[model samples]
Target: MSYQALYRAWRPQKFDDLVGQELVTKTLKNALMTKQTSHAYLFTGPRGTGKTSAAKIFSKAINCHFQKDGEPCNECDTCTSITAGRQNDVIEIDAASNNGVEEIRDIRDKVKYAPTECDYKIYIIDEVHMLSTGAFNALLKTLEEPPENVVFILATTEPHKIPATIISRTQRFDFRRIQPDTILQRMQYIVSQKQLKCEPAALKLIAKAAEGGMRDALSILDQVISFGNDEVTLDNALMVTGSVQNDELLQYLEQVTQKDTAKALEILHQILNDGKDAARFIEDLISFCRDLLLYQQMPEKVENDELNVVNDDFRNFSQKIKPEEIYQMIDLLNEQQENMRFTSHASIYLEVLTVKLATRQTTISPKTPQAAGEKLDPKDTIKVENLTRQVKQLQQQVEQLLQNQSNGQSVTATNSSRPKTTSYNKTQVRKTTAPAKVDLQQVYGVLSDATRTSLNELREIWDDLLNMLTVAQRAVMHVSSPVAASPDGVIVTFQFDFLCQRAQTDQPLKDTLENGLDRLIGHVPRLIFMPQEQWPQIRQEYLNGQKAQKHLTAGEDGQRTEQETPGDPKQPAPKDPVVDTALKLFGNEVVDIKND
Candidate 1:
């Protein structure tokens, strides 16, 4: 009387009629033939995998008056009524809506009664996971011990949510998503059966877009047929589904591959202004890129259906894009899609994404432009000032290591062998008479002549100020260690915090420190910053200067003192003068030192 949709019209009427699931059908058929069907059944799988349809077929097969070889006799009144959904014995329920405990109780109450007309009363519950916990508990008993004449079939897309108790009593059948080739063959058969006017490429596109869902493919085909006056055409199908035309997407992709940002944005704007949903555009773009990748990796694996529907130009374009580039493009589109969902300014987000895509070169390109490269090189924007700052850090380390060595700290083999690239020496010198303390003023004089104009300007006032400090303070100021240098001046960092704190105590003291540093090196120290915690350790070291003076006296004698603490000792020493001094200075604290 009325035209039926393709999905409804082509609904599988028999187990044999179901496509891409012969194993399931054969299993059920064998069970029916031997009267080995379970009292309860669970069907689980993705959408359009025929779980519900298989349940119906099973019901009809068991109830058919003239059943033969485990198949239903369509001519029988029982089979006819079940097929038309008019049979009282075969009941279908949508568990999603009637998932309360009360509904389950009602089913439980009725489950005990025998079938009125058919041999078995079959109950099919779809989306069974929607059942409440209480409902599942109620269904458990009936499922476990139902009447001999009753059968229960529960179906759900998500099987993991089903209670294990309920699952234990049932024969679970897992349905699989139909393969593309399987769906394509079926679509071709359907078109032939109906004598429908369609292009081969159109059918393949429908199959691929269905994504392993037969119902989806049929639904899309139905829309296309309706829009094309009973003839399902490629153009109508693309328009109905709002899929991007291959050529248009190819043009946008070419611009991106070439890193033409302006052209890409212009094309995207044109598409958006034409009323296409940016979100949908992103979705289609992802699909287009995925197809390109699939074709590139395994050309023989590509299904010929709708892919064949694409014009020659689009096919050529798809070939032009490499698999890696297609992967990157898909990733970008997916990111854009996610941003669009929550963004208040979706259009702007889409615009920015398109511009970014256009500015990205092909993934496999050997030579990348500076602005549009995947990975930026650090050398691209080298700053000489940073190198100078790093060099200063190296100098500080050398000064600190030299101090520790003179104090008899253990020298790590790794550290002793480490190389230096600058003018500084990497050689390990045996302790010599703490080399006649270098004269800070004389050092500045030599530096003044050897240094460049920039260094000379910074050291100008520094040499004059150093002439005033005591020899001890001057010795503490060995090699003005480097700090963060600037364009106009350089930073002189002190080796220890005591030096910095002492320099900061008086205005002239600070000026003396800066001028001496500048005079010896090339830059006046600007800001002095130290690791905050290291400052306290440096202060403690200063307070312990008396110990170093004693150690020097002890070293000058023939009596040997331990250079560093051993990792483990078998016996504790009664007490030594040097050990007592260490205990006084450190007060039971552990000080890590290295030695051979």
Candidate 2:
């Protein structure tokens, strides 16, 4: 006999042998015992969860002549032939390959014939969802009115794609993913039966890596056994699964908590150099952080779950990190994991993520006394205490000054000639409240040439413009409106000063708005940001300055009129250009000349 894989050699031949599907096995066994089995059955679940195996077992049990306790007697000739795949009455079809109308039609035609050597003819169609529309239409009629002693078992990972008509006619059983504990127990049984030496921890790790799939667990176990020397250890399991050791993962996490970028990168590089997968490392790290968080919240639960053990080092490390920081780390690691899926440069992203984790600032309050004592030097502690004392003394002095003023007494110096200090004194804590700088000149220039028509056009489609921006950009511009507009630029005023400043400095946001406007309007005008409170004042200041300048100019013109002669032909017209242009364009009486 050729070498057989573990999954193939250990295929369950009876319903009772199936793992992690008690509900399904029990139901099927009861149905078989009562002789009330349905003609068409649909088994749907995730891959490697015993859907097909259960179907095969049920087929054998229903056909076996010497069935005991609703289980097929493997000793019988009928069960033997079916187990060996030599029975003509029981057929297994791969719907993925034969998903055509002709194949379904062939089944429809063959289903009418009576069983040649068995009591019933069973057809197991795996991946039935892969069938074409025409194939489903062809199978629907036969499934609805199958011949007596004929059974159809449809197995698929995705049941949603199956036609409702076909699903309505069949009895559906939904299977669930096997739990890790159940998988571990089964692995232990298999290892013990095969006389293989394996560590308990190794089995547990395999169970976790299986991710609720029995076949996958068995496959991983087979690979590990083949690689090891008759004895499987935790190291061998980790190596096969491309996972890091617990101690190494803890050390890497310690580096992150300590904010040691260099050491964390070195550890990451070593892991990658040793052929560990970057994605797996990230996944393990994320799991480790989650465990730490859970331990922090519920230590008793963590202690109970053998899979989530909290060692002395892990518990100690949990105290050093805060729950909030751990939450942030998990979120960031999850983002990196998402990014790793679409890019081949996973190592680069891993390195960058490592640095981010190492350098991430924690918002936790002051460190614990033990932590502070460990990191702070004695001399630095002394310096901090002295500075605190000096601050207290300064505060006391200010309070005393206020008390003296409230009591209507001046703080007089010891010497009579010296000056008295009072709270109202200008030299006492002078606060320079400088207003935020605004370029009134530029604002005035824009306002002077502002075009109302252009402003109205932009305002009409302002909502549309906002729609073109990203969600974040729209949020930032929500409190803003276009107050002034021109052919060259537009002035947008914000209700809050901070938003005005943000809009002024956010170049990318400005660029996005400009691009959006360019698409909406024919031209992209420059955006000018100003606070609503400051806009009116700046405009008024500009107008008042203009008026003052005009008044001064008119006064100078009046003074010049008194000095200039009416018709002075011999005075060289005072040699003034303004006086000469005034005499040339208008008559001397109507012209007002200014002279220096």
Candidate 3:
């Protein structure tokens, strides 16, 4: 019974009384002064930003018997009657409650009559967006072409909801939220007028809690005043509003900075135990982090109680955190806040959030680096090793299959249609069945030729490698040498340096090389790949053969030596008739023979 909400008591009564909305006030005053006031005027803005107050004052100003300049005389009988809500000519209706077609039709009927005492009949409607479609249609005619003596003043927080047709017939004014300084000044004036005992810090806490809505700030003040009689303090204000004090927030931040999960969770649990809303706590944390971000970015703009919310200790803590990190923290807390709505276990959420934030933040103290390092176990190394082994195995399997496919051999499969006996000469069979069986060098040659033109072309044949081999076997394959087209077949080389690196002898690689070359060329190819370290020796042997004219080019030997051994390093090295013929047809530039 003793309660009087501060917002209602502090409602603005004059144009100058409006806060943080100079544009709206100036425009309305100009309109009133020029006698160019529209019959229907629409006011739109966020809640508690003087939209309704301005509408009411404008209505009174237009019909005041003792108007001065562009404002109403508050002492006049007409102004008094309007303010008291006793004037029939000045009507104030809540569209939220009276948003039916019948209500609008009733107003339409009443608009036909003229004002008896006041110069104009003023109708002020609040929350005009709540009107139903039919009700809006009913009001349309009167709004577009109202009676000469009547004026319709509509106010809405959401102008988008109102039909464009209604908006077009009216003059629209948008209101903005009150600034922090404006709210602070207004609050100070209210405290002085009521003779209330309050700290300036308490006023700032209330202003920040309101988030730019004057109504919310006033309501908070009203609640705080009630909690502590007529005297309001910071503690009492925070208590009533469930806003955790800055000191408590800083303590939580310190625990996190120290990576003290246990302490952090305990503190969070205590907050929950104290019956504070978990979502609201998360929201306040977001706001606290936002202020830290602003402090880091624009320290000069932050002042008043917003400055006191963060102390030197908190400033140091903020300095340790980057703006991006604080923003990420806010984002995470906001997500948790939304999730908490559906979760019955809000405490669990808060605890998890506390651990997450605390665990991720780097400590300000240099002494805790080792402890932080130990906190995250190096498990990724094991995963990386396993993945590398798997990839190697996969590459080996790709090579083996490619070899089998090139050989025209139906790779070891369970199908009954597979040949029971393979066709080959005794030496070829011996080479295939030998202990050092898989010819890796020949497989490399086949793959090299296959991939010579493009990588995409080779990828098509890569999958066929799987179909050509036994399930237990895999071969690490690669194109070791460039391709050269010859009348007999395409020549290639496969690098098997990995085999030597693994300490495996080159016999198996040679066998794989032979089989793969025979399949790719339609006939067995002369393949060459051995230990990389032995490559210089092999090249010397070839040079010795070419110089001596052995096994090939016996007729053209002397003639070829002069032309083949060009001084330019870029020219292809001279080789046997097989290589020379292949290079000539394939284009000499197309071939590259890497010794290793």
Candidate 4:
């Protein structure tokens, strides 16, 4: 006999044999015994949870003459034939290969016929989610209304990919992933049956590696058995799965918890060099942290089957780490795992993650009166006090400035009310008088490169950008409009002079604007804020300059024509007052004078 894979040899033969999905198995068994089964059934779940096995078992039990309690006797001729797959009526289809419209049409064509050997004709379509859109449409009618004696069973790992129309027409059963303990017990039974020598820890390692798949667990176990020459060991299981051992995971976690970045990194380097996968290592760490959290939170209620880490060392180590710290570790490791997908250099991300985990301080649970059990570190408390003081200073400055403005005095912030930060020059006065005159040179420079497309793009995200700004900045920006936008800068015309001047000298506002624009548009632009009162004058100046330049150009062209043609010899060109004077001084040989 040819050697068969463990997954195939130890395939579940009955609904009772299915692992970790009592709800699905019990429902199917009830449906079978009552003979109230739907014509079409949809089995959706992760792989290797016995969807196909359950479908096969249903087919045999429905046809078995000696069936009892919805279970097939497996001794009768029809049951034996179906079990051996010799029953012509029970067909198993792999939808991954035969996922064309034509294939579905073929099934549709044959479904109307009566069964040749059994009471019912069965079609089990595996990986049914892989079927083409056209094929799903083709199967829609037959699946919803198959012949009285025909049954359709569709199984898929990804139900989301299956069409809703197809899903709506069938009785759906979602198979869940088999638990590690369930997988562990099954493996133990198989090993004892085969008289194989295997360590319990080795079986546990294989169970965790399976990630809730029975067939995966068996396959891994088979490889480990072969590697150890039919005697499975913990070392062989670890090597086969490319997973780091629990001790290494523990060592790494301890180092990180103790704030030893160098030691943690060194241990990680050794693990990766020993051929342990970086992704798998990260998963192990995440799992370890999760188990530690569970145990710490509910030591008495923690189930033996719920955790992968069940050791004296882990329990003692759990005492050294806080729940908040574990939460942070999980978050960091999960983020690094996401980062690993985009780059091939997993070690770099791991190293970065190590530094972050080791350097992060434990969250402090303060005993303050404001909020009991809330976390507030001393640094955060200091920050809050500083911010409160600054806010008070800003309020005083605003009140003083408003009072001065009402009395028609110069705008100024009292020295006592001024902010400690020198980066912001709130008290600096512009040489130009109060209505906040625009900088003509800057405005003209912006207009030179301004584009309608750039302005429109700027307008699209104006409201969102305002929301992203600080409260004080948003108040100023809300009354402003982005009038002109170039590749390198934006001109914001404000409705008020104080807001404009305030925005001009506010370094934090500038930083916030640049950061927000960079985040939203991928380009940081120089911001120029001006009052709306100055916009008309600046716009008029720009328009007049453009018109004058055009007129001068036209006048020069006319003079060139006069110099070239002698002016039709009948009519003399009119003289311009400005051009005539310039020509009198520079000579008529230079250009003929023309009036516009």
Q: Which numbered prediction scores highest in TM-score against the true structure?
A: 4
**Stretches of candidate 3 above 4 Å error?**
1-3, 303-309, 342-345, 360-596
What's every prediction's RMSD, in angstroms? 26.0, 21.1, 27.8, 16.2
TM-score of each: 0.58, 0.60, 0.59, 0.62
Q: Write the per-residue lDDT of candidate 4 for residues 1-596, one digit (tens) a residue.
A: 99989988887767788779899888888888898888999998888888898999999988887778888888889888987889899999999999998999999898888999789999999999899766876776688778999999999999988755577789999988888889999999999999999899889888888999999999999999899999999889888898887788999999988899999999999998998888999998888787788788877655456436467997899898888888899989989999999898999999999999999977877567555756778999899999999888788777776666566566543475465432223344443347665677887787767766677789999999889776777987889989788888888998878888888888667766765676578777778889887777776677667656656787888744233435576786554434543333234565764443
Off by over 4 Å in 4: 301-312, 365-596
In model 2, how large is the Cα lDDT of residue 212?
88
**Which residue pairs collide, candidate 2?**
none
Model 3 lDDT per residue over 218-333, tens place? 88888888889889898887677777776778789778767899998888888777767776688788877877887788776654444255568767877887765676677778
TM-score of 4: 0.62
Q: What lDDT, from 0 to 1, does candidate 4 have?
A: 0.82
Q: Estimate the TM-score for candidate 2.
A: 0.60
Per-candidate local distance difference test: 0.71, 0.82, 0.70, 0.82
What C-alpha lDDT does candidate 3 achieve relative to the native structure? 0.70
Q: Give a tens-digit lDDT track for model 1, residues 459-517.
A: 56445555646576576555344322333334354655555555445453454454345
